[model samples]
Target: MPVKAKATYESVRDAVNQLEKEGKEVNPTNVLNLTGGSRSTVYKFLSQLQDEDTKRQIKKPLPELEDLINEQSTAIITSLYEICKHRAEEVVLTEYETMKKRFADLQKTAEHMDLIEEKYQLKAQNFELQELKLKTENQELKEQNKILKDQVQTLKEQITALNKIINKQ
Candidate 1:
């Protein structure tokens, strides 16, 4: 069962890129429609394209990709596949996760600061109330001391007058 693929690999690659640029699904059917090729040939081409893109993403030649590309006695395709879903989507996911973690850390730090602020605010209010109470108590004690001194002075004067009268008699 030989593959009677009339469309060249370049045409297939161009079709996929155009479909992706238009924000369309880069499946075999769409690719087939754009490139006007046999369904089987489109499938094979799409698979090869995805593999090469994956190889580039890993930044090294993968054994699987080598085996795949080698198995194909046809031309070696090094083109792009959703914009190369395995590669592009992975990059997007990595960036998204990094940002999410950063956001969570900042939220935790903010929560800690809020707790510290609340603790200080409550303690300062309590200290201010305690200070006010102490001032009122001190004023009352001073008034009582003045009254006691005046009573002691009056008692001394009365005792001295009585002593002088007894001596004269």
Candidate 2:
């Protein structure tokens, strides 16, 4: 059997972080080589990592000012809140899509199994029908054989009587 790929979020994230630390570009092939993850898994997690980086950049704290204005601080906080909310929504959407795809795949597998089961049932029924037909044919042959044996016994009795009469004459 082929070895299953271990491609969890933590594994992919760690691989990407490690590659970045080594000043290497984080791509599907590099991550696969480093983490032994499949291309699809690496790509999926890479996109998530990119999204996280984008969210982190967007939520970066503003530089301290000598004269901090209350309005500017409130506006910055509100902006950060909005960015966080948007990123959260995007994450939820991604999870929903993934779950939907998994459910669909499961449904297809169940349907395939049902079809296979139906075919097996049909074959078993056909085998039973054939067995019944053979049993009936065997019974008919046995009855015919019994009738033939009875007729041969009657002919032998007649021949014995005729031989006795000839001997007397």
Candidate 3:
């Protein structure tokens, strides 16, 4: 099986920027397709992008204009409002997709962990069986050793008895 690529914020951010530059809608699915990253990763970067945009907007001072330009200001504000609304929708969809993907990844990880735990349990059981076999063999060897020692003692006693009889004769 092919290893999945690790996703990074920079990669997702670049992909989203590229898509935006190409006049494509910056949503989680599109970013995921472009960057080949999980929905969560792409959405994270997109959220960062949105935060940066918001901060920039907050910091920017409104442009001073003459009374004659009031009509242009209203048009500009309307356009900005539309853009913000669209961007908000994209963010919402991206978040939803991210949550879905994250949940899926968690499930896969959980399943994998369960498999690993099962393998370890089997390994532990095998080790315990081997240990038990070794213990039984050790006990058998000890019993055999005791029997040999008793036989040696009996042979020694016989040898001493024979020596005494031969010396008397």
Candidate 4:
């Protein structure tokens, strides 16, 4: 509550206490019936009192209504501050929960990306291995072809030598 609000509430309490000291009951509806204040103002003052003096003790009568009202102002302000603090704590807790959930979601996404990268790396390694095997097989085939060509050339030279000997005879 603002300082002005607290001051207005203090004034209303002072008025009520003065009326009570003058042999009047400080009931909520009587403020309009006895005093000139409206019913709404009386209700507002009662609300301020309820908030300010929940467990407050009154051992002796107050000398002045102004003093009593001023004394209770601190308690009212303190209670209002406590209520606001609790609300702020609730809001902070709610935001913290939301942030925690978002962090968990991001962690899951990162894990999925790691798995995808690992799979791609495995696939690349497999392709390199297959290329190496194909290169080795092609080299062996070229070597075998060279050996077959040499054997055929040697057989043709032997046939030519036999034909020349028969013609000379």
Q: Which candidate comes out best when scored by lDDT?
A: 2
How well does each candidate superpose onto the true structure, as a TM-score?
0.47, 0.54, 0.46, 0.53
Candidate 2 lDDT tens digits, 1-169: 1223777777888888888899999888878877675788878888788768766754666555622454466568667867986998899899999999999999999999999999999999999999999999999999998999998899889889999989999
Query: What are the runs in model 3 whose C-alpha is more than 4 Å off?
Result: 1-90
TM-score of 3: 0.46
Error of 4 at 65 (Å): 3.4
The best candidate in terms of TM-score: 2
Q: Give the Cα RMSD of candidate 2.
A: 7.7
Worst 10 residues of 4 by lDDT: 1-10
Give the alpha-carbon lDDT of every model: 0.77, 0.81, 0.79, 0.72
Instruction: Give the per-residue lDDT digits (tens) of candidate 4, residues 1-169.
Output: 1123223455667656876788877776555444445667767777778655643533335568855785587568667768886898899899999999999999999999999999999999999999999999999988988888888888788878988988899
Can you give the lDDT of residue 108 in candidate 2? 100
lDDT of 3 by residue, 1-169 (tens): 1223755777777776788789999888877776675777777778778777755654555656543365466558657867987999899999999999999999999999999999999999999999999999999999999999999999999999999999999
Candidate 2, after superposition: displacement of residue 31 in Å?
41
Tens-place lDDT per residue, model 1, 1-169, is 1223476678888888888899999988888777776887887788788778866654644488775665452222333344465687699899999999999999999999999999999999999999999989888888888888888888888888888888889
Backbone Cα, N, C clashes tallied per candidate: 1, 0, 0, 0
How many Å off is the CA of 147 in candidate 3?
A: 0.8
